[model samples]
Target: MTLIVGHRGARGEAPENTLASFAKALAAGVTRVELDLHLSADRQLMVIHDPTLKRTTGVRGKVAQHSAEDLQRIDARLGLPGWPEPCPIPTLEQVFGTFPDIEHYQLEVKSGSTAQSRIVLAAILQLVERFGLQNRVVVTSSSRTLLRTARDTAYPLATGLVEEYGLLDPLKSARRYQCRFLILKWTLCRPTLIQQAQAQGLHVSVWTVNEIEQMQRLIDMGVDSIITDYPHLAMRVLA
Candidate 1:
């Protein structure tokens, strides 16, 4: 069966990157929960999709500028159904603590800055070791350098997130990094690209795909996994 990865943990149904959203994704039967990580001012790995909290949380400025304590004071603006308590931005440790049974996790390193990248990488590696989850987590990023760093590390699985359509030979990069998968942006995907990736003995997947028709189309094209905002909707479509 094709793997169903919940993008930002049922983002369409709950606040992105919150524990509540992750629980919702698991409840929806999503095998993997995909989330982005940003390093805080104090080098704590915090789970949030955007570089700035302004868009989603009604806050201003970059996530890396604030310490974890400062982030805790900020509300995550949880707008999910039946949510009765206030939700704070969760740390990477908190996420693993809450969801021990999740089969796989796709951790996207969002910051491209040098210090931020190293800190984020170290923090994630620490967590993986702490939780004994080396075999269950995958590190991925659109930046070749960041992906290379993560891949070069001892992380069990690493993947390159390809968003460029004109990039020369993404498969080669994936192979160079020893990545287990190549995550393609939906717009740049084609049957040929999927076939090429598979022929190279690499796993293929796509991201941020919503809508039943699109999901079905990718499934028909033989995508190994699809990252979607609505895991429940994906389940219905797959059914």
Candidate 2:
């Protein structure tokens, strides 16, 4: 059975990556939660997507430039449509604690130096150990170095995200990182790709699939998981 993951915690219905969204996704029956992580200025692993707070938070600044103390006050909801004001930016550990029942976490490690990635991976691993989620997490990234770091750290599940635009052997890349799965953007994926990955003993998961037709196509193709902003709708479609 294909796993249904709530991309950024049911982003379509609630704020992406917020505790609220994660709770909603869990309530809606998603088997997994996909979230992005970045290092705060204080070197804490937090769960905001962009390198800068501009898009989601409406705060104009690099996330790495701000300390966790400063970021906590920045109001994460500045640009998100409806709000009395803004919401607090959540730390990765907080998100992990919120949905202990939904064990699988598709963790995207955003860019940083190799040293930075190691610290972030270590922090995540510590959280997994603390929560007993080692069996439930998959660390992933577009950066091969970051993926390799996670793999070296012995994360039970790791994935390398492949761009749809480029011509590259995803299986070979997964092999290089010793990853258990390969994640691809929607436009860059096809059923054949899923089959190929599976044939190589690697699992396949695709991201940001919003349309029903595309979701149906990938699910029909037997992807191991579908990462989407709307887990409620995806669950219904899968049902």
Best by TM-score: 2
lDDT of 2 by residue, 158-216 (tens): 55564455477777788878878788887867767778889988778888888899889
Question: lDDT tens string, model 1, 1-239?
Answer: 67899998989888888887898899998869888888889988889878888866678899989999999777786445445666688998999998987888888875475555666777788899999988888888777777766665654545556555746678878887777878888887899989998898877778889988899999999998899999999988888
For model 1 the local lDDT of residue 212 reads 89
> What is the lDDT, from 0 to 100, of the residue 54 in candidate 2?
91
Alpha carbon deviation, residue 69, candidate 1 (Å): 1.9
Q: Model 2 clash tally? A: 0
- If scored against the real structure, what TM-score would every candidate get? 0.91, 0.92
lDDT of 1 at 192: 94
Considering only N, C-alpha and C atoms within 3 Å, which residue pairs clash in candidate 1?
none
